[model samples]
Target: MSQSKPSFSDKKQITYYSRLTQLGIGEEILITLPELSGLMFTSTRHCRTLLGQMHEYGLIKWEPKVGRNQRSTLTLLYTLAELKAELAQNMITAGDYEKALSLIDNDKALFEKLLVHTSGTQMREGQLHIQLTYDRPFSSLLPHQPQRNSERFLLRQIYSCLTRCNRDGAVSDALAHHWIYDETNLVWKFFLRPGLSFHDGSEINAEVIVSLFKELQTRPPYIKELAHIQSISASGALCIQFELRRPDPGLAGLFADVRYSIQPISQLLSTTKAIGCGVFQIQEHSDEKLKLITNNQYHGYRAFTDSVTIWQVSRSKDYNPGEIEIRTGGLVSNQSSSCSSYLSAGKTNSGLSEQVHNRIEDGCLLGILNHRSHFTDSQLKKIRYLLFSNESLKNKLDQSLDYNIEGVLAYNLLPNWVKLSAITDNDTQLPKKISVALFNHKGLEGCAKAISSILADNGIECDINCYSFDEFYRRAFASTLSEDLLLTSVNFDDNRPTSVYCWLLSDPVLHQSLPQQQRRWLYQELEALSSITTPQNYLTQLEPIATTLVASHLLLPMFHHKQTLHFEGLLQGVKMSPWGWPELRDVWFEQ
Candidate 1:
């Protein structure tokens, strides 16, 4: 074979082209203004002169030399493709790299443009600016659907849920007091608080509650813990009874979950009424924006602002409040870092200032495994191994992480939440701890903090690694992923109290993915654990782990951060709940 002549190593080679399709740059040729129209600006002849001047300055290069004698007027042709590349190279090589980088990285124009166009959905002439970063098309914008609630944004403004958190950052006692278990957790009785009502002017009563439970039994979505119920009887005006086959101790905490609480049955019937008993009432709503008015009849603390608006934003640019009018989303607890600074100086470089006026709603994040996958067996085993072998994981899991080692929870929610027979493990069988992974950076920080605090209080010791939400999702959903879990927030409408709990404690009455027997077993385990009291005793059991892990400073607790809105000017005179709402009755806006 003729040895490939040494590839020309030193010669500089160049390729010239009329257009750079990849970069969207094209060479410029001057012809009377006619050609310029198609090549540069079709509406204006001004572009021709602009290109001419650019070539003169050597900012762009001309193709053929200018001639002296020409019929029409001869001018030099320039290559925008070559000019841009040269400019890009100069930016990389120059010491002032930031200037060049800025050309690519700057988003100021984009954001300002979006700000002008967020309201664009209805306008044809003017740009409506709505800013967003990511899109989850599969998500259900409505609460009763199978998808997660819409991702946080200003749109959270118009809606209000039944449960509101307290100043101590705990779900309000009123919400927690709903479920109370008698001697045997199996005979569970819940009392609907009096004076509670939905926005439809309907008082929440036993009948509405019975209808809600029936709905859960018929159309369970996220409700998992209520599966163990053999039957639920609404005892007239006040009490509801849950009869189970066997005694369970963990039932109380399961009821305490805000996601399992009741909503107004009538309001859920129509999207129009905005009939929630919570702090705010819907004034106006569209896919793009929502306006909420404070409920003067709200039974809880008065809202702090006169009105709250949720405006849909565009995804084209990063946000700076100056580019758009500031709006609030779900409020974060004082567990956030900026809360202290805000309380002291009234300002800080954090999202807290914006979210301060928002409110807290009940939610739970859970992990759902893809049991049908080929690697399901290995993943399940791996999760079991990790949860049992890793002391730290198990310790954090007791309170925030709820699972049944027996595997009673359904693989998915399909048809509804209904009672399934209890599963029994052999006497020799040991409970398996579940191995789970969560985002170290996002809401997981709060989960980790809660677990760590419990560990510290109980004198257990452990170490934890920090991770981003993206990484967590990747690992949790990976194919080779054996033994991985994801944290999902369970947000329930008040009208759907027992739905989530039923799902947690029953086999798939709907999806029927996992064997009914296996699901029943899982439900039974969950029900037993759900009956167990966790708030006080949970930390004590972790003492052994705390002594070893925390003593070494391995596991650390970090507080959760949430966003809200605040007003400074004469706007201070506006009266509403922590999250803004136009509380029209007893409250009014001064400005």
Candidate 2:
């Protein structure tokens, strides 16, 4: 895989050779040396070597022209696809799957045939590793750094918090066995479980727990989320205590958030990977894939599954809306101990309840109009109305963004009790041209195209920019400030309203969207809700933030996504978590 070869011996030899065949095969055609080199994706010297290799294989005949910009005559002898297909088939039959699969050369037909049996799941060294086909690469595994729900799920497995939230939104034991609130002193003491160790075999004592919370202060989101903690001190070797400036009704639930996962950062492969005390340990981490091994040193019940490997899979040329479906068709047997699947929402083909788990997530795909742009309030209102005021536009967008698969038209930002149905005031100004930015993702380019097509009919020009995942999220400020609109998805634990408080304080993009006075006023409003003990009272008071944002036309909710997981029938205890992800530790294969 590391060594280079003659361009003719390249796996894409099929594509290059077939292109040459198009130039009146068996008859010399006039073509420049540079043109041939460009077609073959090789240097001029390699072009000559490739021609020689092809001539030896009876694929093409070449004649050289000895002057600059002079034409070179090349005659094709045979078709390349058929020839390479035959060789690759022979390689497949001879057990050289690696070499056979290398002939992708962007050929969809050959790729499907060769990949049919190699994708999905397999057993190696008696470990059960389910290879889930994912659309994006794995993000950092460190606590408070999750960029997606998938990464959040993986991080949840790889780390533990002092407390955990049950499915019902109640606090439960995690690293800490139990906790008691001292009413007199406004303190919380959490009793830790004994015999706990990190993935690296370091003891997880009270001091380690104290260090974890101290570490959280340096990370954003949590830095604001944990602001109520006035002090974190080790009570003893097996206990930890927290002193708060004021009483927090939801402190335990806040601590249970996965963003607050306790982990000791460690170095590996010249990059840092988290060393956590959870049911699973990250054994391999990369952009291509992430593999987790069961943590044998965990305090409580160990993970029943041996391993979970998520493969970062991009959509091939032949892709369907119903499925990203990276697994090849036919001969990829279900007989393996592990499973591999390109998951999508809805009932599976088997019609069995156990075959799939599905639920609507609390997240939303949002189109935020950039307030930093030159657009007036009336213009932003006009754009929002044009995009979402009518039913057909939202429906058309639903299909473009795969929202029809298992999503609902978002009536409001929060999925809970808030229902917004007010008609937008149509009296407005309009922009002649706007620049739109989107995080380059599945169906998003299509989304931009659809929006462009709609705006073109309205005599408005659009400049579209798509940023990679890293570029969009890691740039430290709202990249959309320079554009007219930004399209992205946000997942938050809306089961509790603390997320609303945290997002307002921590989300740079959202924070930058409001005017200076408006932002200051919103911050003061959010600050006033901190002491509210009742969840209903808290949410009721917080309702104005959503109404204010919508009234100002800062952001529009497009759709709410539905998350689903498909697993083999043998996998037991398959269920969806509140945040729309499955806990891998809870799943086990049948013996």
Candidate 3:
């Protein structure tokens, strides 16, 4: 019988595509007949036959862009048909036609190219941008998040411990794993999780625990919560004992303080790194942007996505424009009307909040104020009004003048109080100092009421000098140091209840027992030792110091902060921390 033109089976033709069979040229960037002949063993005559067969089957078409005009030849441009023919022809010259076919069949790179060509190259690049604002100039890793909830909301994967509070706002560990109460209810025993490690690769043991408390003592005075701690001794790697001289219902709440709880003391001490056992690790950080990568080593569940970035920006309805630029050692949060105007107009998406942008502008001008110079009536009234409304104005006061307004009813100092519970029940009145203190300058709601309630219940005079953040800090520093006063409220961002720092006035016995001298000293120390450079450790160190100083008051047992979040994907066993974020281990990606 005569051979039927050496035809290949339909199965073989389909297999070329289905099994990722490589087509076209290899070894030669620019495929020519010579290169193809070297690959295909069949003779040029057989190559011509294969090309005719492929052309008739419409396997490929000619490309004018890559083809050279061959006026003498019928084929103006070589198609895949010619390419395959050339491959076979080259194999024939080598005396191994079957081997050449086998080589194409096993070539992965060729297969990928075929797939890419067939799919038409569907690869693409994606990018994301975020906006953020900070009260202070965006310092390096100095943790100064407004609230634990805000921090947690922004950074989704940090470990946290939450406490359940009683109706009286007392931190109750009754349902906790191990609960014990002593005479004054001043001592607490906590069982630590086993196998916890710091980001610096240090084992979390009693020594680290002791060092943590010690570090807190040396930190800024604002964090005086841990001050009441006479000692913190870990019984084992997993157990610890905290001894206090007096009762404090707020102890459990202190754990919610973001400044107090992030781990890796060494990382906090290092200017280059601020380490935490969160779901994400810092991939890159600048004053205007923060980028994080998933931390595979996290004991908590994984984050919903692989990476996130935050951009530092300011937004405002006003004409102020802000400046964001990289400075030596860190990025500078500079705000000016010119920059704010651009950002607000939506012409420049710098990603800053209006409050933050304005604060920078206000701070820049306030920083240059000279109280010593003679002031015009308008200037003096403005200064007096600002100072009278917010104690922070004291920072701008002339150093030569002693016209200090102490214990004066600067104003009614009344704040509209709101209960944190589902329903307002057994509500306590609030004072002005705490009310003004809690005002969220970034248009944060409920701060005034929250602080007012806490102060009202504490039986202390209600008072505060409500000012912008930078102005508040500058003036508060002056007042806190020279005025011999300590401002106390539910620890900000610690997820502690306002009642923990408030509500002590009702308990006369507890208030009388507290040592005023110690409290004064603690306050002075915080104001004296405060520094913007090390704001993270400074904030972290405040908890223990504050606790130690106020322990005798037996105030709010544990501060309580509540967080509620919304998610679209499967998130399993999510636990909310004081920082207002979810624990990674507690959260699982269902999809």
The CA lDDT at 556 in model 3 is: 21
- Give the per-residue lDDT of model 3 (tens digit) for 185-289: 567776555565655555665567566667766654323555667777867666667887655444554444344454555644566755656566777676644
Number of the predicted model whose lDDT against the real structure is largest: 2
lDDT score at residue 202, model 3, on the 0-100 scale: 59
- Model 1 off-target regions past 4 Å? 1-143, 146-172, 175-180, 184-186, 248-252, 256-258, 266-274, 318-371, 376-524, 535-591
Q: Candidate 1: lDDT of 138?
A: 18
Name the lDDT of candidate 1: 0.37
lDDT winner between candidates 1 and 2: 2
lDDT of each: 0.37, 0.63, 0.36
Deviation of model 1 at 86, angstroms: 40
| Cα lDDT for residue 51, candidate 3 | 44
lDDT per residue as tens, model 2, 163-261? 776534557788888888876787888898888888888788988778767777666656655677899999889988889877766676667766677
> Using Cα atoms with residue i matched to residue i, what is each candidate's TM-score against the true structure?
0.41, 0.71, 0.40
Cα lDDT of candidate 2 equals 0.63
Off by over 4 Å in 2: 1-127, 218-220, 265-270, 317-354, 398-406, 425-427, 476-480, 493-501, 534-544, 567-570, 578-582, 589-591
Q: Which candidate has the top score in TM-score?
A: 2
